[model samples]
Target: MGSLSVLLKESWSFVERPDRLAENFYARMFLADPALRDLFPITMDVQRSRLLQAIVHAVQTVDDPEAFGAYLGALGRDHRKFHVLPEQYITVGRCLIAALREACSTQWTIAHEQAWQDAYAAISVKMITAAAADRDNPPYWHAEVVKHERRTPDIAVLTVRPLQPYPYRAGQYVSVECQYHPRLWRVFSIANAPRADGLMQFHVRAVGAGFVSSALVWKAKPGDMLRLGAPIGTMSLDRTSTRDVVCVAGGTGLAPLKSLIEELATFNRTRWVHLFFGVRSRADLYDLGALNQLAGRHSWLSVVPSLSEDPGAPGCEQGTAAEVVARRGPWQEHDFFVSGSPAMVRSTLSTLSVLGIPRQRIRYDTLTSTVTGA
Candidate 1:
């Protein structure tokens, strides 16, 4: 109702507690939109705490206002999972300011309200700008499936041709949506590099649940239309860096690493690469043929298989992938990328840290969502 610029300036001076801001935001969000209650777990308190912490972490890193805008934009994009709407933003904001007033008590005055409005506007402007930019310059994945091969049990390789070229830096993932089950979507990493033919490959596994995975495993055939999202995730190789690259994956986590390995084989032959892949048993090991080929072509790249159950499998090494990385020697020469279950990510990260791997050098991708069914 008041002048937006004046309110913003006034609010900036009145607000000090970032934690209180976050708490007010979440509290207001849930109060106005009670339907969103189901989106979080029964332990709403924990989720609220984590969300606030993550927001603070993202906001505190704003060296530049534009960077802050991008960060807020990413959060807005991610909020799509909850179907947050434009109207919801206002309600959420009102509730947040109310919560701040109640908590801050004496500090909760008209000036503080103005400052809160200003901060919200700053965040909102950046978020909107970022979202628009993302929509305009979307990631490329306009592909038609040309061939699908059942290479191994639980593993299938799909070769695709795109109407528009889908060039990607290896080690990023794309979300795929199938027509058979319209609403179902799953994320898979590209397994092939940008070959001359322009064909991209995805290595998918049948998890035996969900309409998408089951359809992919039993029903979906070549020539099917599969909508895809642009590549995402920060876990990718920077070829400029000379750091020895160490890749660790569990089960389907191999998808992204495969692309990285291929890319490494093509461009950077001199750089050292050590890939450790973990599987429950021999039955779960997929893409060995391609991995073997890569190893043969690039002497600098070594493939190590770690099977949990049957270490006796021919060519399979014993122990968990983390153990192999630890025992096969300390990782002084390599920077690590890990992807798998949260447990695996946590355990491997802990082990790597104790082994002297710098936290910054060890990157990982953990499933942030709770896996659900149709």
Candidate 2:
């Protein structure tokens, strides 16, 4: 793997359909590594589409071949979420080589094939190293339910205080094991930032099918302990103070973005903040007062509540979050932050894309709410 950039560039140019090449890379990667299959659901065609579009965007933005190295690094970091094993890299590497072979003509000489192999090997090494570091230094997970505040019939804000301090950027989530069924683990993003005392909290909504959510709602109690995985996901704040910041969240997707917006308010950043929250009904919405208080304390922050199912409710605008964004045109000037169900995140991103906001300006995570049933 002498020069991955050169190999990638050559492969990129030789391939007649760059989009197909990008898409095939993922297809082959998954086919060769079935162990990672559960990381994505059967209904992941849209996510597959986005990966190709993201790759195209990355390649087109590169000024020099070497500059694309960051894309590889980000990929390595992201692969950690799937818990990719080091030994399986060889299989993934082989699939990548085969895809490159198919995408490029038989014009690809042995030397070219070897170059592609070397490049994938190098990237695999980087990815493996990152995965190792993540395994070695796992995030603190204390699954102790210190306090439970039932916000509504379906939503409960559990104050989970970990045994070890949960050291994560506000917007990340931790996987909690179900006491009723230890094998089942559920991931919940932190609803609040780590306090000075080191307590971490989660605003969990009880979904009928979710095992962990049901345990929290009906079975789990204070002083009960459970297992939890290290923090993961990337829905953090970007380093931009110039653009207007708009956060769109649906249902429990607001958990992570809540921390991000609060951080922004704490700093009182120059970026004006607008939050568009959408739920099925008024009761489905949580923490409205917290957001309202945040808005009042920070003159720059404004919150809008939207309802998809029951617009006739006490305090909700009519329509889906995507429709609301569409009504508020000229979205080009804002940095878009979105979270919720994978569907919501995807829909919002698609809407923002059509509104002329660049994909790079949007940050989101798709770890949606689900319940485990017995």
Candidate 3:
């Protein structure tokens, strides 16, 4: 009972394989009530990992009351699309505890079990309260795909106009459910700031076996409908900061950064913006043309393309975006926003830390926490 975060974190290490805990949890849940499985996708891989990441994130943030509360609130509201009633949370909590006990094996003490029980009870209350408080917003918004264009073999840009007004900040991402993959949700960053037309854009890449991404990128058409969960993220701009900005994005990670830049363009006049778009080769530089056009229109914006494999590209930086950022030293006075694959984001953040950027000045979303933004 002393420092619940410490108890949870210490027991968290007892599980050697994180995925095993998730798998066991799901197994126990399904066994308790077979019908509960209907609320999830046929493909459980992404969902499994997402659950694990969410738990780990929750545990880590438990020491910070504000962050932990906000995260639980978001999850509570976001999970509404599943039509989960308050009582179902009890079932989930029980199964989760059982799995945690199994994962911790011999090291799991009664004290650890009691702490987790108390923790989950608090989480349930906070989430339930938050979800109930959100009376005005729909559990999920219905949107129709108005446009779908393949930028490459695996990447597609899709535009969807919500049937009703959808409110969100520029850098926030929404969970999207493809019509073809019912109950399967993936997080995709909105590629543009709020538009007069009220259309939202998502950049998707067909990651291996990702049903939602492949459906959106390869099969979705103009008339197809997609369900969108409420937008959630903390990567948006800080209006109070006067520092110049550095945005680093890799591949489809550019979506949120691009949205931030669009938002920045509306009011920016004094601050300089440097955007580094990273890819493996020239063929992967699908949106360079658009970025270049934006940079041309904004005198304070600069777009740099970084190619890790294409050393022959004449105008591009010849390394990963993180490498290029570190090489262009001392962004000591600027705010940093990084997005990309897990590896790229990790590397870029590590590079920034070595450069002594304060944690508060660096904003990056947890992409791994989502099902898949493939």
Candidate 4:
């Protein structure tokens, strides 16, 4: 791990154009195995970015074996829907090394290649082991949309029923593939807890040029069928803990938080919950009514809607959700769940740290890829 980390750091200077590197990598991969090309989406733009990000993540976590192993396990589980085989990892590793060598040009060394090969072998073993262990589980769930409601111009709440039992914890997210855009998947959090009827709900906010989100929000009908990847995420409620919970959500990030809250309600957990839903304006606050109704029914739950743009809106607290949370003060004792865009989550996390909150008590799911087009 140490040698691989050193090699990665030393080779970082040679990566002048990651886009070109990814392009070369894919070209080499396809050249090696033409059949692999069919597994990828038609558009390689976002896929290139994802590849680069994955490489960076793997390199940075090399020293932390536990984190790296967990990442590989999750990757293996997620790639099951794509039908990735253990043998394919060898091809990918070869292409990756070839891309790095080509990118490095004259600077590429035998030591660097050896380090990468060793690192990739270790990664592949963990991934393959995890995938084999998960063979019994279904790769993906075939679901039919039973209800679709446009909550806002760009946001749609969908109710889908899986043909088979789809078991997932509250606050977990799943990759959704709509028929309109084949091979393209977007991640969305389930909005509700598991019900006896086997109904699953998702809240999707369409951003500019989001293929899956746009198709789901606009083109998808009641009878539309969608493919759901294995559920993945760690932002679930800590049921063993008896501490009060503080949930901070921005825009569509409210979906998972709502699920956690509903799960608590269903379990009759009496812990106090402070939920702060933030939006740019009053018009963007789509689920305020539902949240308010939940809060009204549960004495232990408090819903605070914060408007950063339309502060004067009735019942809306002025400033960002993090700002409002700061004003409330003394949040060190609460277990925190923060969700939103990457920026929002980071900002809230920083605020929590400043308030003397322990890192272990803070929970959030870091998105591996971009869901929104932005």
Candidate 5:
């Protein structure tokens, strides 16, 4: 395995364009098995990038069996929606090997082929084992949009009722598949705590090139049906402790943090919670009104809306959420929950570290096509 890792790392250097590598792999895959092509979206751009990213990640983590196995498991669970079968893994592996050989050309050797074969076999077994273990679970839940509100031009708040019981903890996110875009799915955090009626809420921000998000925010309407993947994430509240909590949310990242706060409100503890919601400008602050009302009702909670780029916002603090939290910190005693864009979360985590907060005290879930269960 050490030699296998080294070979892959060295061979990757010969492939100057990862996108071309992904393209070659997919092209060969579709040629070999035409039926597999239908499982993908019309636009292959994102899929290509994801393919290269997955391969790179797998190669990089091959030395860490536990992490690699978990990643493959999550990937397998996510692929259930595509109806991926164990046999398909063989096809993918063959195409992947061929692609690598073509990309590496003279650099490729029989030893490299043998190593990749072993690696792919191991990965496939792990993925198949995970999918088999999850056979009893529903691949996805069909939900009907009962309410859809465009809070801002690019942000939409949706309340959907699952056709069947969907159980998820606060701070978890689900991949949403809109009917308007059949094969495209995007991850969005559940914006509220669970309700007895099986109603789920999602807060979506339509990024410039976000196809699914654009459809959900701009075109989705009441009575439209959508599919929600099985709940997966690791940002839920730690019910074992009643520690003081500090939540730093940027943009739509507020969704999961708000859900966590709502869950805490139901508990009979005196632990204090401070929430700092950050946005680029005052106009981007969508949920401040509701957050303020919630804070007014809950004495244990405090909501601070911060403006990162706009300094003159009437009632908002001036700075990024991390910066604002830094000014107030030395929060060594508080459990921190940070969410939002990847950049925001990363920056906030750095700030927390600088303030002497232990890594174990921070909680966050990074969302992707396949949610990271870590």
Candidate 6:
């Protein structure tokens, strides 16, 4: 491991309360230059978490140059939507150092401060280069909803067509900024493979504290407009792999997997697919009808909707999706895809590890998340 990565990891103990550190950093940044505050959302809660998570991810992966550089590049490309400027990077670095010093309390050493400064410079360079190199792409795309259907009280299935052609792969996700939530951007996985019409589908369930999700589920109509950031993520199909697939989805996590299945259906001549779709109750099986139709049309595909909270529901499995998948596995050879809330994804990954599945065989996109699961 690089000496700086080790230093950052060791100093991580000082940030036991990352939320507070994030708050401190933002407060300092805005105070230092009030104009910068305009770049963030009205609600700072999710933004705080994302900021801390981004730092933590960088700290954790600093030793792996390839992965670390790619992550920073994509992150830089994504940050273009914020309209961040070159000079602002210098201001951010200063505020970040001030926040780190406070986070480390009196225990902070001169060596620690120097290491953090060096680290910040490296991070800023990678991000700036990536953003600068992406000169051909627009900062964002504007799309207007053409179809909207309420799937449940809190869930909605919506389709929108970009004003211009929007290109994206099935499993990738793009950050979206709706009119209702103006500056707030939340990522959502594209629910279908690319079509000639340039229409994109999103399945949203209004989460308790998720403002963007609530707006999309309850307020968005056919004529509503939204802004979309560039596509990111690598959870797409592996055409070279002939192994059958097992997909485990909890609630709306089914979005990306369904897209992959659609892509697979177009070209796959072999390889059976088993999908376990889990929800709290049958009422939450908002897309069951659509899933069933897909299964009916594709002989190699099977859809199992599991109810974690409803054991009495007929025609469905009764357990958490991970639990049911474990019971049915021996999935040692199949390529796997798991998606859901952080808790759900972690649980499923642990189950897969216990079942002895190889780490390389699994693919997922946790990047597409709203205040709630997106």
Best by TM-score: 3
Cα error of candidate 2 at position 106, Å:
17
For lDDT, the strongest prediction is 3
lDDT scores in order: 0.66, 0.69, 0.89, 0.86, 0.83, 0.86
Ranking 3 against 6 by lDDT, winner: 3
Clash totals in order: 3, 6, 0, 0, 0, 0
- Positional deviation of residue 256's Cα in model 3 after best superposition, in angstroms: 0.5
Each prediction's RMSD over C-alphas, in Å, is 7.7, 6.9, 1.6, 2.5, 3.5, 1.9
Q: Model 6: residues >4 Å from true position, as ranges? A: 368-374
Candidate 2, which segments miss by more than 4 Å at Cα?
A: 1-124, 134-140, 366-374
Better of 3 and 4 by TM-score: 3
TM-score of each: 0.71, 0.68, 0.96, 0.91, 0.86, 0.94
Q: What lDDT tens digits, residue by residue, belong to model 5 across residues 80-129? A: 88888889999999999999989889988898888888989998998788
**Candidate 4 segments whose C-alpha is farther than 4 A from its true place:** 1-16, 59-67, 101-115, 368-374
Candidates ranked by TM-score: 3, 6, 4, 5, 1, 2
Query: Which 10 successive residues of model 6 have the least lDDT summed?
Result: 365-374
Name the runs in model 1 displaced over 4 angstroms.
1-126, 138-142, 368-374
Scored by Cα lDDT, where does model 6 land? 0.86
lDDT of 4: 0.86
